[model samples]
Target: MPSSSRSFDIAVVGAGICGLAHALAAARKGKRVVVIDRDAQANGASVRNFGFITVTGQQEGECWNRALRSRDIWAELSERAGIPILQRGLLTIARRPEARLVLEEFLATEMGRDCKLVEPSALSAYGDGLNGAAFAGALYSPHEVRVESREAIPLLAAYLEEQLGVTFLRQTVVHTAAPPRLDTNRGLIEAETIVVCPGDDFHTLHPERIAAYGLTRCKLHMMRARPARYDEKLPPVMSDLGLVRYLGYAERPAAAALRRRLEAEQGDQLANGIHLIVVRSADGSLVIGDSHHYAETPDPFAPESVDRLILDEYAEVFAGPLPEVSERWIGTYASAPDRLMLIDCPCDALRIVLITSGTGASTAFAIAEEVIGELYG
Candidate 1:
C-alpha cells in the first residue's frame, strides 16, 4: 500500500491554473505545498483558453482590479518562467455608432485609464487588414497581454515545481478534502490546510457546496485558423457584440442603445451568445472563438452553425477574407449568472474556490492571493 503519513503545509486539489495559483501563493509564503490533479498533465479550460489577461473590459470595480493585479503577476511570471507573450494590448473594434458611444462612456470612468477611443484612420497603424471592417471607431487599451495558453500553463507548472519546490501528484483523483487529510485514490495526503479549485467538474469534491449556489457549466466553441497572408501583427480584436457582453462597457447606460442595435441587426448571434475575440499566435495562426451555452450538464459538441455565426461576426469586424480553420474544439467552465467567482470558507482551514466566469486565466492569481491571505493571515 501507499504511505499514509505524508503531509504538507498546504494541499491544493485540482492542478489547473486555479490550483497552481494557490500553490504559488502558498509556496511564496514558505509553505510546503502539494498539488494533486486528476489529469495526466495540464488539460482543462485553463489551457484551452486564449490566455488573454484582460484588464480593460472586466467588470468595472473588483473584477477589473483583480485583472490588473493578475496581469501584473502574469508579466512577472512570463519573464521568470520563460513564457512568450504573443501580443500586448487590445484593439476593440466599434462597428456601430452606438458601440462608439459605449467606448466613450467607458473612457470617462476611472477604470478606463490609459485607454483611448481611436479613429478609423488610425486603425492601420495598429496592424494590417483594417480597411475591410465596417467599423465606426475603435478602443485601444495598453493594459492587456496575450499568451498561448497551450504553452504557458505547462511552463508555469514546471517553474512552480523546479524553482519553488512545489510537489505535484498528477493523474491522482482526490476523493475528499477533510483536512488536514485528503483522501485520494492513490493514498492519504496530509496537510495543515486545503483549498479546492475544481474547474467545472464540481461534483468531484464538494457537490453539495457547489450545488447550493445553483452553479452551472458553460460550454464554448472555439477554433484556430491560418490567415491567408502574413501581415503586420494585430493586437487582440473584439467586436460590438463584446460591448454588450463585457461589463466594463456593457453595464454602461450607453450600452443599452448598442444592445438594441445589435439585437436588430445581429439577433441570431446575440441569442447564441456569440462574440468575437481574435488573437494571433506566434506561428501566424489566429485563435478565434467563442459562443456560450450554459447548462447543468453541457453537451460536448461544437456545432458547425455556431462556428458559422462566429465567423459571421468576425467578418463584420475585420475586412479580410475569413482564414482557413486549422483546428476546432469546445471548452466548458463553471458559470453562474449572479457572480464571476465564489470563495466559500467551509471552515477556517478549508476553502472552496471556483471561477464561474471563465475568467480563471484572467483572474485566478489575484483570487488565489486573497484566498491564501484569508486562510493564513
Candidate 2:
C-alpha cells in the first residue's frame, strides 16, 4: 500500500551509524529524510563498537581514502556537535621482531607516509605508565580520533534531530516494500528512495537479500578499565600482536611472511583467538579488547578464556599496575567475504548497505557519500 498520497524524498531504515550516514547524506542534499528504527534510542552496533575513527588501519586505496575523509568529517561533526575527541593518535607497539620488520616495510608504502616511527625515547611524551621495555618501537599515526561511543551515538542522533531537521521515527519497525513503502510501528512512511543500514541484524529485515552477501557475524569482547592517573601523556596504543590486520602492514610484502611465522609460532594463541588493542577513554581509563569468533549465531556472553588472553597481552605490554575493570561488554558485527562494506541496489528505489567488517565509525561518512552519489547521480 502507498504510505501517503505523496512520498518523501528519502527514507532511511535503521538509525545505526550506516543508516545515519545515509540520512545525513540525503538531508545534506536538501532532501526530506526520515530515519526509522525499532529502538527508542539509537543503539546496536553503532553504540557498541569502538568510536575510534581510525584512518590508518583501513584497506588501501578507496577504503583508506574514505576513512581519511570520514575522519575529517567526524572531527568537524565533533566540533560542531559538541562531541568530545578522547584521543587523537594511534600507537602500534611492536613487541615481536617480525612485527617490527613488517612495520618497517609498511613505512615505505604511500599509506604509511603520514605516520612516524617512534622510538623508546619518544614514548615518554605519549604516556608514562606504559612499559616501553616490552616494545622495540611503535608506528605512530596521528590521523585518527577516538570518541566515547556510548555518548557519541545518542549525541549524534540528537544533533541530527535538532540541526539537520531530519525526522526520526523511534520505537518503530519499518516494514519495507518495493517503491519504498513502510508500514512502521508509528505509522505509514513512503519514500521514492530507501536505504537500509541494518548493521549485523540483517536477518531481521532482509535475510534473503543479504544471504548471497555471505554475511557472517563476528563476536568481540571489550572491557572498560577503571580510571587511573597515568603519566598524563600516554597516547592510545595497539599491540603489534596482529599487525597483519591493519592495512598499513597488510599492504607490505613482509606482512605475509610475518603473518605466516606468527601464525605458526603462536598457533595455539591464534586458535584460541587473541589479539590486542588498547584504547583509552576520556577519563584516563583504557578500553581493551578483543578476540574474534565467527559464526552465524554468537553467544552474547564473553568467554573468560578470551578475556584472559586479551589481558595476557595487555599485561605484557604495560608494566604498570593493572587497571581495574569498570565494565565489560560483548559486541557483534557483520563480516562480508569480499568487501569491508557492502552497498547494493536490490531495486531502483531500494539500497542495501552494510559495514560488513566493523569499520562503521571509521568509514561510514565516506561510504555514505558513495551511496548518495550513486543514488542521486
Candidate 3:
C-alpha cells in the first residue's frame, strides 16, 4: 500500500485548476495544504480549455465580480508562477445590426465600465484580415487574458509544490472524505478541513450531496489550427452566436431580437449549442472552439458536423482562407440547471465546491479565497 500516515490542515481533493486554487488559498494562509488527485498529471476540463481568465461576458453580480478578482489573481500568478499571459483582451464582433444593438445595451451596464464599442471602420486598427466591413460593430473589453491551459495548469501545480510548500499526493483516490480523516485506495489521510473539487464526476465523491443539486455534465468540442499567417496584434475573438450563449450578453434586453434572427438563420448551430471563441497561442496557431452539449452523462463522440458549424462561423468573421486544422479534442465539465457554481456545505469541516459553468478558469481563484476565508475565520 502507499504511505499510511500523512496529515494536513486542508486537504484539497482534485488537482485541477479549482483544486489548485484552493491549495493556493490555504497555502497563502500558511496552512499545511495537501492536494490529492487520481491523475499523476493535469487532465480534464481544467487543462482541456482555452485558459481564458475572462472578466467581461460573465453573468452580472457575483460571477462578474468574482471574475474580476480571479483575473487579478491570474495576473499576479503570471509573474509568481512563471506562466505567460499569452493574450490580454477580448474582441467580440457583431455580424448583424441586431447583434450590434445587444453590444450597445451591454456597454451601458456597470459591467461595461472600461469597455468600448469599435466602429466597423476602426476594427482594422485592432488587427488585419478581419471582415470588418461586413460587421455591424465590435466590443473591445480589456479584461480577459489567455494562456495555454495545457502548460499553465502544470506550472501552477509546480508553483504550489516548489514555491508555496504545498504537498501533492497524485494517482490517489479517496473513497471517503470526512474531515479529520479520509479513507483512500492508497491509504489513510488526515486533514482538519476538506475541500472536494471534483471537476465533472459527481458520483465519485460526495455523490449523495452532489445529487441533491441535480448536476449534469457538459461536453464541448475545441480545436487548434495553423493559419498561414495570423495577426499578432489581434486579441481573442468571439462572434454573434456568443450573444445568445454568454449570460452577460444574452441577459441584455436587446439580445432577444438577435436570438430571433439567429434562430431563423442558424437554428442548426444553435441546436448543437455552438458559439465562437477563437484565441491565439504563442506558436502563432489559433485555438478555436467550442459547442456545448449537456446530459446527465455526456456522450464521448465528437461529430465533424459540429466542427463544420464552428468553422462556418469562423469564416463569417475572418477575411482569409480557413486555417489548416491541426488538433481537436473533447472536454466535459460539471454543470447545473440553474446556477453557474455552487459550494455545498455537506458538514461543518467539509465543503463540496464545483464550478457548474465553464467559468472555472475565470472565477475559481476568487471562489477559493472565499471558501478558505469562511473556513478559517
Candidate 4:
C-alpha cells in the first residue's frame, strides 16, 4: 500500500527509546530524520516496567560506561523534553554475608567511584521504609535515575517532533529498511542511511539477520500498588537477588558464593528469576516488579505464585504492610546470553540493533551515539 515518495537523511524503524535515541542523535547532527513505528504510540517494553536507568550494577566495562553516559543524557533531555525525574539514585540492600561481600568487592572497582556503602544501622539516613528488614548493609550509588516511562516516552516523541524537527510515521509498519529505500504502509521513504531499533520484534524487517544472532524474548511480571499512605520521597530499592543477577556484581568472583547461598535458601526466587526493583511514581503509587521467564513466545499470563515471590522479597526489604494491588501486567523484551545488545551491519549504510539486556532505557542514548557516529563517519 505504498504511496508517494518521501526522503530523509535517516530513517529509523521503531519508536521506542532506542529509536528515539537514534532519531535524537541523528537529528542533533542536523540530519532530517523520520521515525517509523507500527503502533500509534509507544506501548512496548520501553513504556513498561520500572523506568530505572541503572548504572552501578551494569556489567562493569561497556554497559556500566554506557549507563553512565546515558544517565547524563536522560537528565539533560528529561528537562528539555519536559519529563519529570520522579526519583534519583539506587539503594541495593544486601541481606546476606555473601551479598555484602559482593557489594564490597564492587566498591573497589573504578566503576564505584562515587558510590557509598551504608551500614545497616544507618540505612534510614539514606531513605525510609527499611527499618524492620534484617539487612547486612547497602550500596548507595548516585548514578541512577528514574522516569515515568509511560509518560516520558510520549513526551520524548513529542519533543522530537515539535522541538527537534524529527518526523514520525506512527501506525506505519516498515516492511523493509534497506538503505536509500524503505517500504512502508504509508509510502516509500528514501534515506541515505537506515537504523532499525526493533525493541523485541525481531522478525519484522530483517528476520534472517536477527535469527543469526540467536535471540529470544524474556517475559517479566510487574505490578503497581497504592500504599494505604503514600510517600513522595521513596528512592528505588533493590535487594540481594539483584547482587547475584546484575552482571556488575554477579560477574565478580565473590558473587559465586552469593549465588550458592541464594540457591540454597531462596530456590523459588532463583528459579523464577525474581528480583526486587521498587520505584515510586509522581502519583504516590509505587511501580514494583518483576520476575524473569524466558521463552521464544512467553505466556501472557501473570502467575500469582511469581507475584507472591516478588512481594515476599519486597516485604523483606521494606517495613510496612504490602501495598494494595492497583495494577498488574507483563512485559517481554529481547534476551541474549552472549551479548547485552546486538548491532548487525547488514551493510555499511544500514544497521539493525536490539538491546537484549533489558537495559534499553539505561543504555540506548550512548548506543545511539555509537551507531550514528559510525554511520556518519
Error of 1 at 312 (Å): 0.8
Segments of candidate 1 deviating more than 4 angstroms: 1-5
Q: What is the alpha-carbon lDDT for the whole of candidate 4? A: 0.91
Q: Please report how far candidate 3 places residue 241 from its true position, in Å.
A: 0.6
Q: Estimate each model's TM-score.
A: 0.98, 0.94, 0.99, 0.97
Shift in Å, residue 241, candidate 4 = 0.4
Per-model RMSD to reference: 1.3, 2.2, 1.1, 1.5
- The C-alpha local distance difference test score for the whole of candidate 1 amounts to 0.90
Name every residue pair that clashes in candidate 3: none
Better of 1 and 2 by lDDT: 1
Clashing pairs in 4: none
Give the per-residue lDDT of model 1 (tens digit) for 9-53.
999998889999999999999999999999999888998998999
| Clash count, predicted structure 3 | 0
Q: Rank by TM-score, highest first.
A: 3, 1, 4, 2
Give the winner by lDDT.
3
Per model, how many backbone clashes are there?
A: 2, 3, 0, 0
Could you tell me the lDDT of residue 148 within candidate 2?
Answer: 88
**Candidate 4 lDDT tens digits, 1-377:** 23333788999999999999999999999999999999989999999959999998999889999999999999999889999999999989999878999999999999889999989888877767784358889999988999999999999999999999998998999998899999988778899999999988988889998999888999999999987764455569999999888999998899999999999999999999999999998888998888999999998898899999999998888888999989999999999979999899999999998999879999999999999999997
lDDT of 4 at 366: 99
